[model samples]
Target: MAVLMEKKFPVEAGAYETAGEVSTTIKRTLKQLGVSAEVLRHVSVACYEVELNLVIHSDGGALTLQVEPDKVTLISQDVGPGIPDIGKAMTEGFSTANEEARTLGFGAGMGLPNMKRNATEFDIQSEVGVGTTITMSFALDMKG
Candidate 1:
């Protein structure tokens, strides 16, 4: 009784014009698959947060979605200038976004926090000069 679906989308830094497209597609796909509305909202928020992180932070990256009957998984992987201190980065309201990103009403430092809040489980890893990866999962039946 398990169903599986997977998808991947590319995200370019400073791609404001198309920043949320991937997340939107993911939302649509989940809706078509009959995912519950609550689960869909959580997935949509987390997906957009990760997508925006790539658009505003990384040089480039990919957002991946893996949906199973019990849970939905999101993995965001990006290249270059990785976080030096994940502890600080995770702190709500902490941001390192550039002026351009800030000017767009983004970079409020809410992306990571929002992602964590929306997902049932969350993990992040980074290496300076290398890259970063964030993994998040939402339980399909939970009241989250």
Candidate 2:
């Protein structure tokens, strides 16, 4: 599989001031690449959700974007203080976000569910103290 373009955005924990910048940029990048509207919508939503997760939870992380001939991939890798229960985390309305995040009108606990709903493919792996990683892929209409 050949990648047509790729970029990575760094995210810092508690950086609510610029939480959605990455996703905004990702959406723009996809649009510039001529990605279909449907695929762009899915990627943008999932990207924002995962980006917010990094801002609220991870010590720090990077969100990578890769555009292949037939797909667009987003991989989020974070450091330390990983999830304790993936099942519970995936459940709607369950959140461990701090007051800062909640105060900012975030941490509704719908991040994971929204990501899964928007992405064509989604996978998450987390450890007690080793941090978490999530990968999502959106299939594109390569014919166009």
Candidate 3:
């Protein structure tokens, strides 16, 4: 339950200029921490996917990465216009991305799916008028 290290990055909605910067920093930090390659890979993919979601979907959000002795946790909390249907959103090839986001080659409807695939554990919570919070955990062990 104790964190060994933690880093937080603020993501602005529609900030296409610096979408993946935080995820890049996270990968570097995990590598420097001597985390295994497999675990780092999972974390990197999920981190980027969630970060991009904040940029392309949320009004704005903050991403926090916490490293514990046994696991790595990536939490993304975003504000406003939350997802209406979690079931539909989870379906592949189902996207409601704006024209700008689609033009940028994003919003292929793979963000949530990819995050779920990469993380050992994934959970999401949201309300219609509120915000969305996604938490993904990667176990730092071979057994995972």
Candidate 4:
């Protein structure tokens, strides 16, 4: 599991103005690396969802992209205030988004659910006072 490439992008909470930049950059980077379209699409969607969660939730954190020979991994780690109930958070249409986020048409409570749906594998860890971390992996088809 040697990493071929890696990049970390810092995300600020409530930074709606720069919300999708990190994910878009990740998508472009993967495209330039010749990743398969299916994998790219999955990564792109999951990546965007995680990025948005960072902006809308958490205090601030980093989104990391790791590219290996057979898979792409996205690690999103954010500072407090953390999720107390990960199960509830993962449920579709369940969100703690504030009115501002809703006004921007950003938080539909679909972030975690959508990320899990798009990624090949998904895991989330959160501490009420510590922070939250989400890891998602998309398997690449290198056979082509």
Q: TM-score, each model? A: 0.95, 0.95, 0.95, 0.95
Estimate the TM-score for candidate 2.
0.95
Please give, for residues 2-50, the per-residue lDDT of candidate 2 as tens digits: 9888898999998999999999999998899898887888899899999
| lDDT computed for candidate 3 | 0.92
| Model 1, runs deviating above 4 Å | 1-3
Cα lDDT tens digits, model 3, 66-127, are 99999999999988679999999999999988988888898999989999999999999988
Per-residue lDDT of candidate 4, residues 1-144 (tens digit): 999999999999999988999999999999999998878888998998899889998899999999999899999999889998889999999999988889989778999999998988899999988999999998897221
In candidate 1, what are the lDDT values of residues 17-134, reduced to their tens digit? 8889999999999999999999999999989989988998898999989988899999999986799999889888899988988888888888898899999999999999999999
Best by lDDT: 3
Candidate 3 pairs with clashing backbones = none
> Of models 2 and 3, which has the larger TM-score?
3
* TM-score-best of 2 and 4: 4
Alpha-carbon local distance difference test for all models = 0.90, 0.91, 0.92, 0.91
The count of residue-pair clashes in candidate 4 stands at 0
Model 4 gets an lDDT of 0.91
